[model samples]
Target: MRKLLLLLVCPLLLSAQTPADQILAKAKAYHDPQDIWPTLETTFTFKETRPDGPDRSTIIILDNGISYMKINRNDEEVYEVNGEVAEVLKGDKDKARALVLRNYYLYLWGLPMKLYDKSTPEISLAEDEKVGDKLCKVLRVVYEEDTWYFYIDDFSGRMLQYKFYKDEATGKGELITLEDEIMVDGIKIPQERSWYTLPEMKYLGTDILEEVD
Candidate 1:
């Protein structure tokens, strides 16, 4: 009778302690407790440094899904897109560059918090792993086009690093270390990100969030 009782209780406890549920709860609380994105209205500056090229700076403003991006490489205002309308403000902006910048800023600045988005991809818990010196709880997210691995700090429940695969089968990808943070309007945003090539760990450019509001 005692063994049967223990078995029943054990199953209940396991169901109550799913890894995805626990990790997501902590992640959401740490990153965006107030759900700022729906009414998010803010501006920030991104300074990018690359080993192969001159530094580039951009000022980005996102007001409720409408976006304006200014590319400072040549002191040019390159793109502006709002709802159904899109424009190339100046300097012969191409659609490819515009799209890259759009996704780049949106993805990096809105991380961990963005994991909770309504359109968020399918997410599941993976085995725990160490990122740099910190042990992390791994969350694997699969989008339509790519798969991403987010490493949440085991102790603080904060996202410390992430990896993305260009080809999931080959596992060739990049890893980014998220460092420094600033709280803006109840959102914890990473202020700097350094990227490195996977396996080889080649140094890539760093994107620094210089200013925010």
Candidate 2:
């Protein structure tokens, strides 16, 4: 009788740690050094050399928790992706621009500043250590039925990488990985990035940033 009682109480004695709390703690510990991220917003330039391509021009802009974005590419048309087709542009940089913007927004906007809210579900630590040099805390977020995974830097509170996945009958889920970092003006930046549609084939992309502050 005592053994049964103890066994049931063991779980209750264990601290209730949710995924969101785990991620928040990890990020806070990692980024205890910088306040720069709180003001992150600017245009990012992409020097694209993908799966098998030479190079191209691309630019992305993000402002105010990233409610808006604009893209311009050398050989592509400008099309926006914001839970829907946001807009279109007719210019030489439209295609490449839109591609970069879509990918960038997909990669960035899916994160959390205050995750205790109900919008993010499955808030706990996941066994996802393949995204970066340090261990990553995966936070499963859901807003209005749409969900995503945010990979945070364990040693630095900054969000160094993010991924979006969806299961479909015809097409498989895709994976995007961020890596090859360099510090520019005290801010860590991604020097090289790769995207895998089937977790096999990867498209290499570059980020060239210029400070405007």
Candidate 3:
């Protein structure tokens, strides 16, 4: 009876240790070891640089526990969204745009921690691949409209790059590469995010985290 019990438990353990689960767990441990991101409240100031235009600075405040976010662009109040209500303080009163910004900022910064959310899309593992010269483990997440692939450093488990595609067959989308990091509110946030066109690999823009308070 003891031998049978051991045999049953071994398969359960092996099955539970999936490649996707292992990669995500390692990444979450590196980024937010204390698991403090879900209730995190903080401010981040960053600059967006592009070859085609002048640099722009933006400030974003996020309080996830209360589902609140506010964005300021170029020293002007852009919008703030609290729960279901969006207050547009500048520019056109577009509630949808405000809400989109709220989600985009929160999700992009939250990263591996956000992947743990129950409402997040399904996640699976792809074969090991290389981004640049670093060997990475790929995590494929399927959303409602598009699919995203995240590449995590094989050794350190840090997120190195990610790409999104509306249609995988077309191979037309953008790839965002993460570099450097900053520790803010006990969370390891990427300092530079460089964007490039997929396939063509044309340089687009980069967002650099300038300060956090």
Candidate with maximal lDDT:
3
Model 3, span 108-198: residue lDDT tens: 8889788898987778998899988889999999998888998989998889989998888999888999999999888898999999998
> Which has the higher TM-score value, candidate number 1 or candidate number 2?
1
lDDT of 2 by residue, 62-147 (tens): 54354566666664655554433366765544345555667455344323443433434555455666453577667665445344
lDDT of each structure?
0.78, 0.54, 0.89
Query: For candidate 1, lDDT tens digit of each residue in 1-213?
Result: 999999999989878866886787687778887877656788777788999998888877777544444334435756765643556667776766666767666777888776766788668998999987889999998887778998988888888989988787887889998889988788888888999987779999898888886
Task: List ranges where model 2 is wrong by over 4 Å.
Answer: 1-19, 28-39, 65-68, 75-106, 109-122, 128-135, 142-163, 168-171, 182-187, 199-213
What TM-score, over all chains together, does every model reach?
0.82, 0.54, 0.90
- Model 3 alpha-carbon drift over 4 Å, by segment: 1-17
Rank by TM-score, descending?
A: 3, 1, 2
Count of backbone clashes, every candidate in sequence: 0, 17, 0
Model 3 global lDDT (CA atoms, 0 to 1): 0.89
In lDDT terms, how accurate is model 1?
0.78
The superposed Cα distance between candidate 3 and the true structure at residue 211, in angstroms, equals 0.2
RMSD, model 2, all Cα superposed? Answer: 8.7
By TM-score, how accurate is candidate 2? Answer: 0.54
